[model samples]
Target: MKSEPEYTPFELMAVAGARELKDGEIVAVGLGLPVVATFLAKRTHAPHITILFELGVVDPEPIHTGVGLADPRVWYRAKILSSFVDMLGMVLHRGLVDVGFLGGLETDAYGNLNTTLLGDPKGKFRHFVGSGGANDIASSARRTIIIIRHEARKLNEAVSFVTSPGYLRGYGERASAGLQGGPSRVITDKAVFGFDPESKRMRLESIHPGNTVEDVLANLSFQPIVPDAVSTTEPPTAEQVRLIREEIDPERVYAG
Candidate 1:
């Protein structure tokens, strides 16, 4: 059977995250982009990369299917199936996971994340679905990576709720909260961004293909500073583009 083509943007984001994985690393991946990246890494160079699903499965070889942890395939491919109690204990207390790949409802210049709620405090969106194990994922992983669609609405000046707990109050303060690793890189539709050492703010590192640095900056809600000589986001090589298009989401892929 032949696999369908990939839409450009999702492929880009998946490749962006997939390229970061190292063999033998275990990533606590969120849904969607996380799923694509993990599977892509598995098929390519990092077959040893272990992916820990929040639902408590590990290193599921998804074959050619696009389904995730919920897919029946996961049960067959997974090494273990356990309770949230055991998984939480392992994730938060045992110190086992290496990296966390999380998605955000929105992110701010400070890198604080909001994924569970939308509206606000007091009466707006009164009760919330709330954050998932993301709190633990952020607290335990050695490093964190965030994937989000780029836009003014999704990238705000300040987060509505610090649900996922970026550098609470500030960077070192996360250590005080017992959070091991806060967001290290935030990849988006238009560019790649990271936290500045001194200011603890996000700065533009690279722009995506077909988009100019000015275009990325213009779409952001607040000012995003560029380095003296900003670099372009590396395009996915022919290898990455092929796997993402073929095996990841063969039916149809999403674009930015």
Candidate 2:
């Protein structure tokens, strides 16, 4: 029998995130793993997936792994080279984008994200890159997917500050605020979580290979609703692994 291919946690995370996207859907992609995931999706299963960068490149075929959205590599072969205002206001704010991918320093049960600071705003604290267009994309996209590292400190009962709205107070609160959609799924190294339809709280949907419910629970600060029939995340196929290693990110910039 052929043995399973070795893959890193980042590769697993990217593949898992890529699977959430569908063909013919327009996705507002951010930097880091979200960029890698969307590229992998376009190269493989969702060939028709449209990728839009916050800096205003639409359907760009990046020549190589990019440092950020504005990198020249990301601007290669772009279908639309427009201004930031046009992209965010005309495209995103109009609700044309199907999904938005985001990352943050902290997230809560309601999926509220804090990419701002670690402690009280008035006190000395570790500061992170503030929201550029993350807040706008998260609020206006039809659905949003958050990708973050899984750790007890990063997963909180409530983020220190709500940089981007998720379900707000949960359930009807998001709709009440007139937001079209809220966080739909969260992809992590250990597991996959989805929001409970009624409660709007994050729930354990599936665990990644080599991880268990106990492992996931141990890393999370708060108790996430667990379904009885949690499934294992689909492992990356040999072909997918090959594409990621050789074609997608040979330098191991984001795929590592």
Candidate 3:
């Protein structure tokens, strides 16, 4: 028998994100890690999952994993290459999507995301590719999963700007804004987080393998609520590792 290949941190993160998805759910997938995780989920467990790209590709089983959301390879064997307005406006806004998978530059305890600007939006600072369709997905999807790197700077007490609403000011604020759903989970290299019931603040649900709760705490700019019995995140199984390496990302494009 062939020995199982070692996985990287990114691979671990991807697997973690993939495990959150359930069978038959329609997922609005953005670029970067979200793409890899959604694809892996479909191939492994959620075979009936409908994946929608921001660029209007729906349920495409690409010949190969392309570089980003806009790549031509993503459209392979697509069920429908619909127009942008039809995908986002009709499908997403009409509450047809089950989950939105997104990535960002920074996130807060409230799960608010900031992907548009760095530092103060008022002053001189760097600007990223503005919310292509992340804002729409986050606002309209039934729930969302955020995948991002864990660090002090990335996990802040408050994001510089709310590119995508989470709980907003907390406890019904999101709902008051006419948004249907909000962020349900955040998967990082160090841990997995879910929102508290009453407070709507992020709670450390589990620490990743080889990482401690203290390590996760140290990296966050704000104090995340910790459960009394925090568990360790399940490590990727050999099958998951194999599929990610050999089938999902043979070229190591994103999973690497």
lDDT of 1 by residue, 1-256 (tens): 6453344767787877887788888788866777788778888889888777777776666554545456766555778787676666766448878888888778888677887777766557744656677777877777788899998888877887887777765546667775666778888978888887756678888887789877887788877557888887777777777766666656543322
Task: List the candidates ranked by TM-score, beginning with the highest.
Answer: 2, 3, 1
Using Cα atoms with residue i matched to residue i, what is each candidate's TM-score against the true structure? 0.88, 0.97, 0.95
Q: What count of clashes does model 1 give?
A: 0
Clashing pairs in 3: none
Residue 42: error of model 2 in Å? 0.9
Deviation in Å, model 2, residue 16 alpha carbon: 0.9
- Maximum-TM-score candidate: 2
Candidate 3, residue 61: Cα displacement in angstroms equals: 1.8
What TM-score would candidate 3 get against the native? Answer: 0.95
User: Candidate 2 residues 134-206, lDDT tens each?
Assistant: 9999899999999999999999988988899999878899889888798989998999999999999999999
Per-residue lDDT of 82 in model 2? 86
The lowest-lDDT stretch of 10 consecutive residues in candidate 2 is 61-70
**Candidate 3: tens digits of C-alpha lDDT, residues 116-222:** 99977898888987788989988999999999899999999889889998998788888889876799999999999999988899999888888988899999899
Q: Which runs in model 2 stand beyond 4 Å of their true positions?
A: none
Clashes of each: 0, 0, 0
